[model samples]
Target chain A: MKSHVFRPLLVVIGLVVIVLIARFFYVPSDFGSHEKGYMYGWHRKGNEDEWKAFKVKYQFNNEYCKDCHSDKYETLARSPHAVINCENCHGPAMEHPSDPAKLKIDKSREQCLRCHYPLPYPTSGRANIRGVDPEKHNPGVECSMCHNPHKPNLRGMK
Target chain B: MITRRDLLKKFVKTATGVMIPLAAFEIIDPKKLFADKPFKTDEAKVRWVFLVDTYKCVGCGLCVKACKTENEIPYDANVTRTWVERYVVTKNGNIYADTPKGARDGFTTNRIDLGMGKKQDIKKEDIKKAFFVPKLCNQCDNPSCVQVCPVGATYQAPDGVVLVDRKWCIGCGYCIMACPYGVRFFHPKYHVAEKCNFCYHRINKGMKTACVGACPFGARMIGNIKDPGDPVTKILMTERVGVLKEEYGTKPQVYYIGLDKEVR
Candidate 1:
């Protein structure tokens, strides 16, 4: 091969090496910085777009959720659970109200495990397990299936 | 046909909608309390509810006194961890609510208005006619507090108990906004959202709630809806019971049997 082609090939090879190295050490899941960026920064949607263009990745406004879900907002405002954010359980609903059809709200048991999955993290505690293994517990069988959120744990409750 | 202006417009339109809240959720996750119960209801065998008959109320403030003594709630704070508000309605469309309230810890005869309370003069005959609404957590079927709990802290149990995981809660103050009945509040010492747990500590051990046991009027009832013969189930089937804030779609478990139509 001519020197011109040979030199260009080496440059491309060198670029590939650099890119690979960056990807390995910089995968977003490891530090979660990239995931945060992907979730929050680079993925910003337009200010006044239609539901058709709305994506689950779109940023949400609590006030917007409070618009339709005002009752939840009022009840939760002073509740003991008030410090917790709505997205932690509902799982990022910015896109939910926009199209609702396309936007996923994490309604499944796996979704509940996002934070509640009783990890060995030592902070969640084994006693906090409430009896079952968070890893093996299936909400489909029970747990949230019968419980009412408005008022909880009354007399003679099973 | 993509005009440069239109293309820019579309691009900009699509950008901002996705950015703001995405950024917000990062910091907000730590603050959520979960209302794990959905906005729907399934028939429960052991549905728990509370009933306070206005006619039975003698304005003695016994329940109020009982609540403060039991919960050790601060009286000076003017926060009823569970207290009664008196209302006096007259024929004139004039209503004077929260009149002559009392408590175990220094409750005044003064008519202190509570929670968007109404103050209107009624006919002299209408005086002392208002009933007591033993206000606390309604424990709705579709409880708004549970709906807004970001962390799933204030969730319903499998057997139909709306309990908060006081341990995992971050106390973001969202459920306070979510509840229409104005039941829950921030505990000053615990610094988390707190309300009537129906005396779970005692009830779990087969004892009744303090308020329930203390009521001399037999106004309150407790039972498992799962049982065919439970009193609450019987009353729900036999008597006309009412729930507070029904218009908001929160199907409260606390049923007011023999509740007056005009009672708020």
Candidate 2:
């Protein structure tokens, strides 16, 4: 009888319906909303673009700083520090680019010591950044004693 | 001797029973598993590349600290986005390696307190040659981490930087194990796989990576390799570069200059 075949088909259909309903709940509606060309073809669900919008809160580029401090920028270009960005030590200048007075120039000794502190590393290392032990090299004296911050090399400046 | 009306009624009942179950079972479609929504695809504008001059690295460890601070990573935690390794070969053909706190506080041969010290005291003069090699995620052309992530949470961005979606990550360590370089780790706080993203947050803003910016020596270099005007690109074109584990065929984007044969 046709009823005999229909009974088996009905059971199979019941199982399929349960699986389909489970999938609908398990799979998120927005699975691939943000990840268009990313790896694994999976969409990024995080605030991946937050850095793009964070520009309004911070700016670290040196080009805008060069606008107002062109003379210093010119000097830096001629010195060994040419490649270093101004914001490395001075912090982000997003506000300073607009209001020049907002720029915070850090003249602390810690700033200079960050790069110049002496560590007993291998002599063969080619940093070209001559390190000095703070207490032994120039005890109680400021780093600006013998070196110019803008042009550290006396021979190069001359 | 059955009536026509009775037979018709039985046929109708059987058909309804079959069709109702069929409709329910047909609801599961495999296409839905891979169905992707239309999103704005950002074109690959610049392919960023990072270069390390192994001969020039002084084991300063400033890059590690800078990365830690930039990424707001805790100093004491086992998680490190980047680190450096010092490879020392003794004259007697003994190999010694150590990276205390990932060399975040620099390295010194005088001290061997990282619990990696040898049983025999080897004098410094007995060492044949030693050098520091900085390590980070290679950002391979064919990264295995991307292939193993079950949820597709870790992926390479359009700019060619491998990144992790912390929000979507189910704390699965598959990507961590998939990386052959041992660069990936599970963040203790976020509970997700974390690796060097090349500081995409900074690079996207047209700024150098935290490690590159922190290096006092011009040992670490990064730039858009595609742009001819980029100085880093010029260096890459001129220098004879090598990648770690080339046999793996990962095709890592990070190139190294003066890489010694001993380094793995």
Weakest ten-residue segment in model 2 chain B by summed lDDT: B33-42
Which segments of candidate 2 are over 4 A away from where they belong?
A1-39, A45-129, A132-158, B1-45, B112-127
The number of the candidate with the highest DockQ is: 2
lDDT of 1 by residue, B1-264 (tens): 899998997886577444333322344232221222222334433455665554454333444545554554564555555666555555556555553333332122233445465533333354534455566677665666776776555665434445555554689989877778777888766777777766554455555566665554555567666676876677678877777767888777777754655566
TM-score of chain A of 2: 0.58
How high is the lDDT of residue A26 in model 1?
41
Which segments of model 1 are wrong by more than 4 Å? A1-158, B1-45, B99-123, B126-129
Best prediction by TM-score: 2
In the order shown, the candidates' DockQ scores are: 0.01, 0.20
Candidate 1 lDDT for residue B145: 78
- Point out the worst 10-residue segment of candidate 1 chain B by lDDT: B30-39
